[model samples]
Target: MLEKVTGLSDLKEILHDKEDEEIVFTNGCFDILHVGHVRYLQEAKAKGDLLVVGINSDESVRQLKGKKRPIVPEMERAEMLAALEMIDYVIIFTELTAKNIISELKPDIYVKGGDYKVNELPEAEVVAEYEGRIELVKEVRGASTTNIVAEISKRY
Candidate 1:
């Protein structure tokens, strides 16, 4: 599973060889894995031949989600995502947005949760620049890491 976790450069080279395959890209902090994340990834995989997940590094997550967030560290989060059968590759990035990765990979499809609108995504431009398709998967109602963490804190 750890083998599925790769750096951007290595993954780029590997993906270059897979030009024949339709590649799907999605990114998130994935601070705490949940059913919503699984379903989203599964749906993203269905969009193309390969699914590449870009995980926000600890610093990035901290910047986006606050310092107390990401109860699970970056490497552990990457490993957990890499272990998923539907995910073909996992890359940890230090960016607050997926724009850079999306620009570099130029995957055939870029996916996000339904909660996001295409016009609002910073990476949408990058995807569009390369003529990549953007997809939004419907989110599992009431299923989110923020809610889960809130519930845990309330119970504890």
Candidate 2:
């Protein structure tokens, strides 16, 4: 079973004993788990001791990715992410952006794909405020939900 955390406070208590542990965080819609997502996560986890993923809720995904997005529900997405041995924790947030969660968790390193500019993301400011590191990983081409959806639509 995947361990569930309700809020930020619960998050602190869970890592209280391991303050020195490097916490790497990443957030995304994760509507459909694919090779790109997995590779990105693995790279992020390599830089820290713990990998915490902040998943946008189903509602939030729709707001960002449009109405037809999030082919999978938030719970299912979170559960799938948690199942990966490289992912240490998964938190689902109702917000479209992960700024709130980033501030709350204050992870040692915040990671995003190369698609985003380091200075442009909301999480970037949060990481800056705490003097945390922000890593822009190499993007995986043809590994986006947009392409995935298009492929499915072409088939059916």
Q: Write the per-residue lDDT of candidate 1 for residues 1-156, one digit (tens) a residue.
A: 999999989999999999999999999999999999999999999999999999999999999989898899999999999999999999999989999999999999999999999999999899989899999999898889999999999999
lDDT (Cα) of model 2: 0.87
Candidates' C-alpha lDDT: 0.95, 0.87
Against the true structure, whose TM-score is highest? 1
Candidate 1, which ten residues in sequence have the lowest lDDT sum? 61-70
TM-score of each: 0.98, 0.95
